[model samples]
Target: MRSHGIVLHSLRYGDHRIIVDIFTEAAGVVPFIVPQSRIGRNGIKASAWQPLALVEVAWQPNVKTALQRPKELSLWQPWRTLTIEPRKTAMSLFLSEFLYHALRREQENRPLFEFVTKALSWFDERDDQFVNFHIVFLLHLTRFLGFLPNVEDWEEGCYFDLQAATFSRVRPYHIYYLEPEESALVPKFLRMDLRSMRAVGLNHALRHRALEIVTEFYRLHIPEFPESRSLEVLAEVFE
Candidate 1:
C-alpha cells in the first residue's frame, strides 16, 4: 500500500536496522523497519526519517507482525525552513514527540490527517513571528483529539474545567481546572489561527504558562500522557 506519512519518532533497532514510527494518512500511527542499506547516497536518506519529516511510503502489510518494512520511501514534501531554522526545528521535535504519544492509538481519520499536514506545511513556510506557534498548534490539535474545550461557553469570571472540557462560573470539584485568569486565555487561544496568532503578543512567562496549561489539559484527557522532555529544549530555544 502507498501512503504519505509524517515521521513521529525514529530509533536504532539493532546492528543494521532502524525502527521509525510514522503517522500516515491511511493508517494512523505505524512502525516501519528500515535497513541501514536504505540510508545511502542512492537510496532513502537518513534525513527522511527525522522527526516531522514528510514522506511517501510503499509497504506490504503483514497481519502477523506490527512492524512493517517500506519497499519504497521518499520525501513527500521537503521542508524549506522547519528543519533548518533553530526555533522551528525545536518546535518540530517537541511536536513530533507529543504526537507520538498523543496519536499512538489513533485510527485512520482523513480530516485529522489533513489538518496536521496543512498545519505543518504552514508552520514550515513561515520565517518569523512564530514563537507562539507551538501553543496555538497544541490548542488547535485538541479539536481533532476529541477533547477540545468549549470556548463558546466561556464567560467573564469563568473558570475552565480541564477534566470536563468546559467553562463554568464555579470552580471545578476536582483539581484539574484553570483559574479564571488563565481560563480567560483559552477562548482567545481557541480563536487564533496560525496567522492571527502572531498578533497576540506573549512574553516568555505567559507563553510558557500557556504551554503548561495546554500540556496539562492533554494529560488530563489522554490517559498516561507523560510530560514532554523536549519542552524544556523548546523553551530554552525560544528564550
Candidate 2:
C-alpha cells in the first residue's frame, strides 16, 4: 500500500538498520524497519528518514504485523528553512516529540494530517520572526486531539482549569490550573494561525512560561505524554 506520511521519529537498530515511526495517510501511525546497504545500494538513505520529513511510503503489510516494512520511500517536500535554520530545527524537534507522544492512534485522521502538512509548509516559507509558532501549534493541536480548551468559559478573572479542560471564575484546588494571566494567553493562542503568529507579543520569560503551561496542559490531557527532552534546548534558543 502506497501512503503519504510524516516521519515522527527514527531509531537506529544495531549496524545498518533503522526503525521509524510514521503517521501515514492510509495507516495512521505505523513503525517500519529500514535496512541500509554498504553504499550506492539505491535504497532509502539514512538521511532521508529525518524527523518530521514528509514522504511517500510504500508499505509492506504483514499478517501479524508488529512492524511494517517500506518497500520504497521518497521525499514529498523539502523544507529549506527547517533544514538550514537552527532555531526552526530546534522548534521542529520539540514539536516532533510532542507529535510522537500525542498522536498515539494507528488510524487515519485526514483532517489532522492536512492541518499538519499545511503548518509545516508555512514554517518552511515564513521568515525568522515567528518565535511563537510552537506555542500556537501545540494549542491548536488540541482541537484535533479532542480536548480543545473550552474557550467558552474564558472571561475576566477566570483561571484555566486544566483538570476540567475548561475555564472557571474560581481556580481549581490543584496544581493543574493556569493563573489568570497565563489563562489569558490561551485565547490569544486559540485565535492565532500560522500567518498571524507574529502578532503574539511576549518576552522570553513569558513565552517560556506559556510553553510550560502548554506542556502541562498536554500532560494533563494525555496521560502518556512524555516529558519533552528537547524543551530545554528550545527554551535556550528562544532566550
Candidate 3:
C-alpha cells in the first residue's frame, strides 16, 4: 500500500536496519524497517527519515507481524527551513516527540493527518514571528483527538477544568484546573490561527507558563504521557 505520512520516530534496529514509526494517512502509526542498503546514492536518503519529514511511502502489508518493509520511500514535502533554522528545528523535534506519544494508539484518520500536514507546512514556510506556533498547534490538535476544550463555553472569569475539558464559572474541587487568569488565555489562543498568532504577543515567561499548562493538560487527558525531554531544549532555544 502507498500513503503519505509524517515521520514520528526512528531508531537503529540492528546494525543494518532502522525501524521508523510513521503516522500515515492510511495506517495510523506503522513501523517501517529501513535497511542500510537503502541509504546510498541510488536509494532513499537517510535525511528522509528525519522527525516530522513528510514522505510518500510504499510498503507491503503482512498480517503476521506489526512491522512493515518499505518498498519505496521519498520525501513528499521537503522543508526549506524547518530542518535548517535553529528555532524551527527545535520546535519540530519537540513536536515529533509529543506526537509519538500522543498518537501511539491512533487509528487511521485522514482529516487528522491532513490537519497535521497543513499545520507543519505552514510552520515550515513561516519566515518569522512563530513563537506561539507549538502552543497553538497543541491546542488545535485536541480537536481531532476528541478532547478539545470548549472555548465557546468560556465566559468572563471562568476557570478551565482540565480534566473535564471545559470551562466553569465555579472552580472544581479537584486541583487539575486552570485559574481564571490562565484560563482566559485559552479562548484567546483558540481564536488565533497560525498566521494570526504573531499578533498576540507573549513574553517569554508567559509563553513558558502557557506551554507548561498545555503540557499538563495533555498529561491529564492522554494516558501515560510522559514529560517531554525536548521541551527543555525548545525552551532554551526560545530563551
- Estimate the TM-score for candidate 1: 0.97
Q: After superposition, how far is residue 162 of candidate 3 from its true place, in Å?
A: 0.7
Better of 1 and 3 by lDDT: 3
C-alpha RMSD values across all candidates: 0.9, 1.5, 1.0
For candidate 3, lDDT tens digit of each residue in 1-239?
Answer: 99999999999988999999999999899988889988878998887898999999998899789889999999998999999999999999999999999998899999999999999999998999989999999999999999998888999999999999999999999999999999999999988899899999899889988889988999999999998898888889999
TM-score per candidate, chains pooled: 0.97, 0.95, 0.97
What tens-digit string does per-residue lDDT give for candidate 1 at 1-239? 99999898999988999999889999888899999988999988887899999999999988899999999888999999988888888889999989999998888878988989999999888888888888888888899999988788999999899989999999988899989999999999889999999889889989988988988989989988999898888889888
Look at candidate 1 and tell me the lDDT of residue 178. 89
Which residue ranges in model 2 land beyond 4 Å of their true spot? Answer: 38-41
What ranking emerges by lDDT with the best candidate at the front? 3, 1, 2
lDDT of each: 0.90, 0.85, 0.92
Q: Which sections of candidate 1 miss by over 4 Å?
A: none
In model 1, the clashing pairs are none
Clashing pairs in 2: none
Instruction: Score candidate 3 by lDDT.
Output: 0.92
